[model samples]
Target: MIWNLGSINADNFYDLPHLPGPGETLTATRFRQGLGGKGANMSVAAARAGARVMHIGATGADGRWAAQRLFEYGVDIPHVAEVDSATGHANIHIDPQGENSIVIFAGANADIDEQMIGAALSEARPGDTLLLQNETSGQVYAAKTAKALGLRLIYAAAPFSAAAVAAILEDIDILVLNAVEAGQLHAATGRELDALPVGDVIVTLGSDGCKWISNTARTTRLFPAFPVVPVDTTGAGDTFTGYLASALDRSLPMPQAITLASRAGALMVTRRGTADVIPDLREVQDHDFG
Candidate 1:
């Protein structure tokens, strides 16, 4: 089972000819709304990849539909509480090149408390996976609880926070971060990539691929990205993280899990949209990487 202490967001996407410059106002050619948030997206991705996923997060009454949507994707959401605050949301501006600039408002996502986290984690057993992101509150508590419970803690260090990462670093079993985030983390810690204290670190390179640094083996391996023409790179990283976690939970080896995750991420960028467009396991399996 995979327990996600994550965020749920109402993603608002605007398609524009080009990203707006500072103080520049431009009209978007199209606008669409969908389910999003790193936590929500990864939960959906894990479910679609055939893992038993439980999403532990909060959403506002107005965002109840977002929680309901997770049901359709096969994510268990008994721990998702409806709070008094507005639903968290993102305003995403996508340019013709498939690059995007985003502004996030953490509303109900910031309302996660220790009580909620404890209640959700109580259902998890030892050896189950606990996944976390920086989008929501209670991460430190979640990390501590998961550690005490003997769960395998996986941290996706996104929207990078030095304090947050430092607080949970000792508790995390596997650490995943994208290239830019890795750079920032390196800057914050004043350590080389391989010298981090974590046992396993995976750094994702957008087009080039991913790098795996195994502290246990004292070795690093590079896994190349599957080639694809990207339409919108919005949720590719989340898709990769979700699939990777699911693969790991199923007892797949690190190399195999990374290969499958690379496929899922490559497939994600071929389409548009966020959580709505994540590829299912069958779609990924049928994809001809050749």
Candidate 2:
């Protein structure tokens, strides 16, 4: 099972012709509400990719709907707790060009405590992949504990935080992030990507491709993404990271796993909405990884 320890939010999205500048108000043509949050998004993506996933996070009193939404995606919500607050919400703007700008209200997500973390880890065991993001502040330590309990830890170091970045250097099986995230870590530690003091790092470069140091074989390689017209790139990174975990869980070799991940990311950009847009294993198999 894949365990996702992060935040869950109810998202409100508006479609504008273009993004507005700071303090500027713009009219939008359409509006929609759905499930969102780093953890929720990645959980749905992984579940859609055919992993049996468990999502652990908090939902607001009124926001408990987030759990229902995640359940619709086949994600287990046994550890999703509801507190005396509104479920966290994201105010998002997606322009005609598919660029997105979002403002988040953490609500119940911000109330997650260490006790919640312990209860969540109680459900995991060795070899199960614990997929974590930066939404929850203290969840990093719980990830380490899961690792100690034999879980293979795969972290997506997004929206980098100082403490989280510092914690990532210890015993992570796979550290996944975008190019900017990769640069941030490299800059912070002043170490070559190859010399980073972790198990392995995968730096995703959007349309350009991805770079990584192989954990098993210890080889550095780069893979270019297959060209496609991207309709919305919102969850491409999540798709890649989730599929990468799924591949590793299935015991695929590194090169084949990267290919699966790259193809999954490429497929995600060809659609809209993070929840329903993720590609399935068959779709990934059909994609040409050229």
How do all models score by TM-score?
A: 0.94, 0.90
The pairs that clash in candidate 2 are 126-150
State each model's CA lDDT, in order: 0.94, 0.82
Best by TM-score: 1
Q: What is the C-alpha lDDT profile of model 1 across 1-290, one tens digit per residue?
A: 99999999999889999999989999999998899999999999999999999999999999999999998889998999999999999999999987889999999999999999999999899989999999999999999999999998899999899999889998999999999999899899998878888889999998899999999899999999999998888799999999999999999999999999999999999997889989999999899978
Candidate 1: worst-modelled 10 consecutive residues by lDDT? 190-199
Q: How many clashing residue pairs appear in each of the predictions shown? A: 0, 1
The per-prediction CA RMSD against the true structure, in angstroms, equals 2.0, 2.3
Cα deviation at 151, candidate 2, in Å, is 0.8
Give the poorly placed runs of model 2, Cα more than 4 Å off. Answer: 16-29, 94-100, 215-217, 288-290
Candidate 2 structure quality by residue, lDDT tens digits, 1-290: 88888778878989998999979988989999987788888888778778899888888778767799889889999888888877888898999977788898878877777788788888787788888888865566676678788988888888776578786667677888898888788778777767766677899999998987865566889999978898888889988988888788777877788888899899899988886667888888887745
Candidate 2 vs. true structure, TM-score? 0.90
